[model samples]
Target: MSQFIQLHLLTSYPPANLNRDDMGRPKTAKMGGVDRLRISSQSLKRAWRTSEMFKSAIDGHLGTRTKKLGIEIYKKFTEGKVAEKEAIEWAKSIAGVFGKLKGKDSGNADAAEEKETKKKKGKESDKNPLLTLEIEQLAHISPGEWDAVMDLVDKCISEKRAPKLEELELMRKPEKAVDIALFGRMLTKNSRDVSIVEFGEDAACQVSHAISVHPVVIEDDYFTAVDDLNKHEEDAGAAHIGERGFAAALFYTYICINKDLLIENLGDNKKLAAQTISALTETAIKVSPTGMQNSHASRAYASYVLAEKGEQQPRSLSVAFLKPIESRKYDDDSIAAIKKHQENMDKVYGSCADFRYSLNAITGEGTMKELLEFVTK
Candidate 1:
């Protein structure tokens, strides 16, 4: 068995009351003869994206001070990297695709209008028509869109473009560190209590990244930064603000503080890992359900990674999530979406097809709360 931290998070509204039958449909059961929370991982991740921390984190990764994505694109195009025709077409297409401006389709124009009216009667789309517009601009960059970016830049330079709510949205940064890239590596490894042979058991100073041989979990947030449903028409999104948000998966690097001593005793790794896990047991009480901010946890991680690291001196370990593309496709879906969401993800793997690392294929729902106590031998 491996000694590590296990975190359990779920959406507050999802009620955690989950039960599945033989066919995996909603069923009911009693543990203490009572119903418990049934939640989905997707839902849980959504909640975390909406937290304040995630928003701040997104701001941290991408600058939030400017609203020049359109402006930036425009500049790039004007500089002649992209043709003017293409840039405008991109802007028009993206606006059409993501915008809710569709009042009617030719086949059922009247019917469509009626349906739209009914929908608008309730909750309605954002009050501002521009909300969807901004979101669309942020979604894609084409030749025309690039010109729009230039236009935006021009506007901002002339103090024309104003920051909107959409500009505030941010995305999570998954590949800020090589070590976190490795954490996904260790998580996929099937061996339990398997001390990495690459890094010395007691090598503390060199430990750039680490992962719990067990589970590292986070609390669920109700608001998500990258949710498909949260897309807006006029939000202008991070693009309007010259900032961006992570609407994708994230990777983190961890370290064992008591590595040297644990290695010397061998048996001590469990205790140290357990204790350290305990300290991090407190899950995020507040996170955005919509904004999965990618804050560089390196600074904060330093404390957690080097926690209780000593004058007593001890060896440490570092691990990174295998570059997303480098890790084996635990399944087909992961491979498809993992890299598409983050373009840089593909670049990191380069031509190295050595992605043999495993992935923790969590099947059932419910937080593995008890795994927190799973001790290492």
Candidate 2:
């Protein structure tokens, strides 16, 4: 079996804000001394992991990333007819096993602001006082850990008491959570006993921020919304006007998976590991970031895909685009450059990969099934 699997992809999107900057414009990076649109690794991973396709493929093998575990626990206990005060305390005790509780002194600015906003609106924010039970950070809870937590919740409600210290040991090796095994997660030490907490897992896969292979010029789309009720000539003017930033580009994405580490992360579950790789690879090739999709509808599949497997150290083919591809023959040139670079790299580095397969949509060279098999097999 190969130790490493590297994927190179070229996908094109038209006039869309696939990923956005803080200012609501398309995200960009200065690469090779040129401005190129970028889709952040974080954004890409979130899209792939949360996509319906990935979720359906690995339905039972996913984890939930949330800070509302305490809130959920409190609600569950309350629904079981537990007293409000007791429920909050019990929920805190259980949630604290995963991460620090968001207390009055926790200095969580966002929570504070939300509470203050509710107060200003003359709403009784304390109506759901359990909101304060939320944790300080998002916890990635595997299905196993979640089941354990729920079991403890049921016990506490039935026994009419808080969870025992031993029962609070909710951390479990993620045998079923493929998302956790692929991306990994960090769990803070238990507030009660640091030694009792399971720390974290190292990510078995690394994703690069997808960047365009050519220079980009972001453009603004200015338009107006019309009011159908207004029929008079004086009311012919648009009801609302706005402008949004957009750009079109062909992006290059790279992913490297440490198959050995992935299997180990899943507790040596080779079958699950293969499924994870297949699901992830398919998601990467098919899923598009949801940002501004309603307005631009910019969904795309990779036009060119290169999948390589080996025990050798992985390297990205991004260096091929250091000199931007000309717009005249952008897609063809970009693909050619990548192929040439891989060939050159093999010559200089003595075969960077042991086996390789490619799917070129432009040339109709290979099937998706064949490519998936080549990588997962």
Candidate 3:
């Protein structure tokens, strides 16, 4: 089996905000001593994992990242014909196991005893409404673990009591979801209460932040929206007007996949591992993160991809742009630069991978079908 799969992709987006920074501008990073438009690895990973292509390729194997476990539990119990009040209590007990619960406990006699003790001193107040228990952070709970949690919640409600902390700890165990295996999870809040011994799974795939091959010059698109309801009065200029930052660049993307870790993450299922690699590569090639898609409509597929498979150590070819590849309208400067980097790597590392395949859109040639076969085989 191949130990590693490395992908080098060159994609171009024209005048769109594919990813944004805190200031709502296209994310940029300084690379090769020049400012280059950047799409974060986090953004890229999310777009691929949640893409329709990925969903279809690996159905029912994806995990959900959310903080609404309490709401889900509440809905499930109520749907099971449990009363709303009792359901909320049951949900709170289960949620508290994941994180600290705010407000007074609404469940058992221990809480009622405290309430009565406070009332004896005339200190109880009706101003506080019941607050639902919530996890401090969004948890990446797998489908199997969700089923387990639901079952435990059902058991708690059936017993007519709150869940014990030790029982809630069961939710933390890894359930071998594909996305969890690839992206991993990190739970810092209430880690002591869960069965998770580590902070998060070490990601088997490493994605570099996508950066423009050439220096980027930010452009501002100024525009206005007319009020459709307003009569076209001479004085009725516009309903809204805004300025947005946009850029066009040929981006360089690099990804290194550790096949061994990937298989382990998928519970030693070789078939699932192949499916994961296929889904990841396809999504990475096709999906652009939807940052301001409606506004800018920036969507594009990779112009070129070089897929390599081997048991050799993995390395990125991003050093090709260390001098900043010069791009032109009618020229293939970016592609040429990457090719030069690959040649240099071959000369230096003496064949970086066991096999290599190339796909180029400009030439309208190269085999994605064969590359996928190589990676999977």
Candidate 4:
């Protein structure tokens, strides 16, 4: 089996803010001495991992990322008729096994202040008293760990007592959480038993920020909304007006997968690893960032895909666009440039990859099914 898998993709979007900056304009990056529209790696990964394609492809092998585990536990216990005080204590204990508990000085000031104000008014605070039981940061809990935690919760509820020390050994090597295995996670020491926190798994995949292959200029779309109930004779003006930034471009995306690390992270389950690779590949090619999607309706699939597999050190083919492609025949020219760059690299580096397969929608050279098989098989 190959040690690494690399993917180079070209996708085009039309007049959309696929990813945005703090100012609500499309994100941009300076590349090849020109402004290029950008979609961050974080945005890309989030979209792929959360997409229905990925979820359905690898159902039950996903992890939940959350900071409210304690709150959920507390609610479960209280709803099970456990005493408020007991519920709080049990939830805190269980949650502490995952990460540091939020303390009075650990950024729960708003909740604390609200509780005190309610007390001063001689009324109960509507906030759950166990709100502080939450952890300080988001914990990516594996499915196995989640199951263990839930089992302990059920046992505690049945016995009407707190979880025993042995029962709190919740952390487990990730075996079923495909997302966690792919993206990785880190868990800090919890408030309970500082020595019990397990180390995190390193990510098996690396993703690059998708950037346009050609120069771009952010444009503003000024528009208005007319109230449906308004009469044209009474008021000929629009009821609402706004402006938003958008851009259209062909983007280049790169991804590298450490196949060995992925299999190891999945407990050496080669079948699951292959399944994961297929799911991830399809999602990455088909899923679009959700930013301003409803307004812009910009969704796209990769027009060209190149998949390579080998033990040789992986490298991106982004240098192909160091000189932006012309708009006259941008798609075809971009594809030719990428292929030429690869050939040039092989001539110098003596073949950067052992094998490669390509799917060119413009020329209709390969099919998606064939590309998936080429990479995963």
Name the top TM-score candidate.
Answer: 2
Residue 3 CA error for candidate 1 (Å)? 22
Query: What's the distance in Å from true for residue 122, model 4?
Result: 19
Clashes of each: 85, 0, 0, 0
> Which window of 10 residues has the lowest lDDT sum in candidate 2?
117-126
Residue 199 of model 2, lDDT score: 44
Across residues 250-307, which tens digit of lDDT does each residue of candidate 2 receive?
9999999999999998889998899999999999999999999999899999999999
Q: lDDT for each of the candidates?
A: 0.28, 0.87, 0.79, 0.87
lDDT of 1: 0.28
1 versus 4: better lDDT goes to: 4
* Cα-based TM-score, every candidate: 0.23, 0.90, 0.84, 0.90
Which prediction has more favorable lDDT, 3 or 4?
A: 4
Q: Report lDDT (Cα) of residue 335, candidate 4.
A: 91
Candidate 1 structure quality by residue, lDDT tens digits, 131-194? 2223311221223323443454344335433323232121122122111111111111112212
- Show the colliding residue pairs in model 2: none
* C-alpha RMSD by candidate, in order: 22.3, 4.2, 6.0, 4.3
